[model samples]
Target: MAQQLGGRARSLQEGPGEYRLDNGQHILIGAYTESLGLMRKLGVNLEQSLLRQPLRLRYPDHEGLSLPPGPPLLSFVRGILSYKTWHLSARLQLLARATVWLLQGFRCKPELSVAQLCAGLPSIVRQELMDPLCVAALNTPSSQASAEVFLRVLHDALFSGRGSADLLLPRRDLSELLAEPAQQWLRVRGTQIFLGTRVHTLKQAADAWHLEISGAPQGETQCFDQVVLACTSLQAAKLAEPWAPAWAQAAQALHFEPIVTVYLRAPGSALPAAMVALNEGPDAPAQFAFDLGALGHAPGLFAFVISGASDWVAQGLKETGAATLQQALQAFNWRCSPEVYRVLAEKRATFACTPGLQRPGIQVARGLWAAGDYIAGPYPATLEGAVRAGKNAALACLQV
Candidate 1:
């Protein structure tokens, strides 16, 4: 049971308008095997629902790092060498760092932040690639993001398989991509999905696990044999506190970072590519922008996403929106004047994936498991992380 239909990944309508805005722009790399595999299993047409392309940090005016089609490692090497934007020494510095990471099998000192790991690289390389990639993947700045987690993401994307480095951008609404289809898939299999339902408390009993529910017409209690808590870390912590105080504390101890998505509307405006990486600065609140028109969505709609946006959140949405508009204006030549359409911020969008941060494990109590992106795992807080955690919990519950 979930509090919301999509649980942080859904589309919402603003001002009763026909157009819907997503909480933020989400990008899935080809390395997200469990998530992609599950979507395929749910009968989601991968080709129709997603736009796949070789991962490249393409800027507005010039090409940045564009990986060619070939073996993963070779493509990475070639891509770095071919990009003339960086001095050859800067490129070699990146390659040297990567070689060291690979030799170490992508493992690092647990306490090292991503910034420190890439500190020796050229400033241009850090600014153009590592910093943005670190924030996008971990939702935490490189200075605080975990080096271990970042390396793992790199390993999976660049060294795992052929298409693992490809970027998979959503071509449909967020709900249509996964949430709604997943709900439908479960309903046909005789699973009862209780939307707008809340499990207030969980109590252990001899025969089964008794759940103290809220606003149930029949009663306030429900029974289950094996249960998996798939709600947010806060909700799961409350229910699991009595059973597993240590686990609950760990879940609660996690710090979070916010993400802001500023949607801008420019009539008949089109971007050079489907996605463009912007130069984030003191005034620029966005790191990446998406041409929704190019992504098979509405025409002339653009999403400017600011990951790790604590500073922007403090500045207020009004200021953030205005700054984002100015940034957009400076970056591209618009068909007409672009206006701030909407600014959406997820305060607790993702946990601050800092170095040495601890997360709660899946097992909470006897025959009861916990699942969410916040669960302790190799990966950071992502759809792939959440899906894999849920899948693992399901498999574990099946064993019992």
Candidate 2:
């Protein structure tokens, strides 16, 4: 929408060089139809940009789940029935619970947590599958995450259509893959981009919105018929304080969860799979690990991600990174000892997706709207949710 509307977006780091170095790694899925569509519109070659694979969760020693290609329901059933990691009775229990959820239309009360919803399932299933899936999707522990949102995500990925459950790993940096392409696409359409600019205040005047922006030579005030605040929840709250106090309060009230990504480099070594699920605990903090070499990046470059990482962050990035390195060494086989390259932590990676949490809607006020993953939406804070919110905000602006 920024591209179509002829405006520029800013970043703390310039270009795809230093910016890419600091950005967190992200993964997408075929279920993110809106994000894929937007990428296609921006001229990204999906086939080349993403390495697609069916749902597979391989761990060290090649122990985990991998669904085969087939009809969604059949594949799910077959995968569960064929799982050898758990006892036959446990698999049957999972299948029975799945059948009940399907028969009940995946409906659950708004206040129900994922742990509560899956209370009847085998502990092994909850530990290996449900816990990891919950943290990955909602960035909240299963004990606190909303069950309704979890079911919605599962419905879209496993039952929506073919390939929906497939993972799309980016082969390059995020700016090169999406942000730069989007900026270039917008530039061709005569959009005026203001790099290094920040908006100090946003106010309404009669029928238009006014923005007082800085960070540019000769600060200027701009006016627009409609405005979309595509920024962090806190920044949006600060900007909306004058016009939307209720929205600001709600935004401020929302708590956040952290994510830590630790990069380890082991020359001449590679993981068994492109991605692997790790047994997270006090010793092993990472929930998932990615082998960048297998995904077309530098050989032996591995990324260990710790979602819902508040405790790890408190321990310090360096300490966390060293501990994760030890965890990787013990978990996987390597040609050589791996060294810690960098540890990236986003303190406020996402709003805590807790059960019964109230998020503010997109429409903050008349002629004002918000476009962010944190806004009230069916999905949690994901790339697809942000893209969907942007598209919705664009349509709302057009309608006005």
Candidate 3:
């Protein structure tokens, strides 16, 4: 309503030359019902745009946990038990810990970090599964990530129902999935579509909300009965400072985590799977790699994603790209040496999903509302969270 994108992530980006690559390399799970429903409503072809696959954490050696197709609970148990690489004790220990979490309704203390909650688990399970999972789901390390949110993600992905954990790899660019279709849908509904517009200021008048936007005719102030601040948190904070200082401060107080995506172009190469989980160490900079070739988007292209990349960000992008190139060389079998095609870093990719994190709520004032993935919610800062927040905010605005 405000801009072309209501609550889309900044991960989708354009690269130099003719190749249109995703800068942040975002992945959506089957549990993201809100986003998926929105896409379907926009008349986008989900089957053609996404490559759905069962949940698998396979490595180059094909040694990792994988869920089979069946009843959700049975599939999860079978997957965990059949993972032969983990010791029998390690597997049993994981099951026991998971049972405890499930019995407790997948809820935990808000102050407990993921590492603290899984402290007694076997080291192998932590290294191979929990650590990467925490980073991927929360975009934060286990020691700093929130246990409550981690459990929520696990519940939805592993235990909610069948296909809930399936990874929806984008076969097309994000523009096709969200922005383009959404814009067309809005335009079809008689909504005025304005590109390259900025809301310079916002103020509450006696009877209506006033917005000083760039695209307004003759520099007029646009008046509306209700206003939804669907822009970035920083911009929302600045606009709401005059109306709601406390909410503005809360929005400004939230910290952020960065994500780095390194795209590699290898001539005539492919990975064993569409997506593979990698081990991250002091020298290794990537946690997961996606074979764009396998996803049917590109022929010999790959994307290495480094979530919770605070340390990697400090070392500089060139060093990070070089280290990732070396890591890829050792981790996978390539037809030719992979060269770094482009390196993209999102400094404020997500709000730090840490323990006891306080986020701003959607309600800013009586006649105004806010929406973003960073708004207070059960889910982490993700595409699903953004969609749900925007829908709720719009519904609330309509009711008022």
Candidate lDDT values, in order = 0.91, 0.85, 0.87
Each candidate's TM vs. the true structure?
Answer: 0.98, 0.94, 0.96
**Candidate 1 Cα deviation (angstroms), residue 70:** 1.6
Scored by lDDT, the top model is 1
Q: Say which candidate scores most in TM-score.
A: 1
lDDT of 1 by residue, 302-380 (tens): 9999999999999999999999999999999999999998889999999999999888899988898999999989899
Candidate 3 accuracy as lDDT: 0.87
> Per-residue error at 15 for model 1, in Å?
5.7
What is the C-alpha lDDT profile of model 3 across 1-400, one tens digit per residue?
2443533342344446557766577788888889999999999888999998777898877768888887667888899999999999999999999999989999999999999989999999999889988999999999999999999888888765778888888988777788778878888899876666788888887868999988755465888889888877888999999989999999998888999999999979998888999989899999999999888878898999999998999999999999999999999989998999988888888889999988888999888999889889889989898889999999998887
Tens-digit per-residue lDDT, 1-400, candidate 2: 2222212111124455432342466788778999999989999998987889888889887668878887667787898889898999999999899888889788789999999999978898999899999999999999999999999888888877888888888876566667788879989999777776788899898888989988555557888888999988898999999889999999889899999989898989988888899999997899999888887755668889999999999999999999999999999899999999889888888889999889988999999999998899889989888889999999998987
Q: Roughly what TM-score does model 1 have, to 2 decimal places?
A: 0.98
Cα deviation at 399, candidate 2, in Å, is 0.9
**Model 2 worst lDDT run, 10 consecutive residues:** 2-11
Q: Lowest-lDDT window of 10 residues in candidate 3?
A: 1-10
Give the poorly placed runs of model 2, Cα more than 4 Å off: 1-22
Q: What is the lDDT of residue 76 in candidate 3?
A: 80
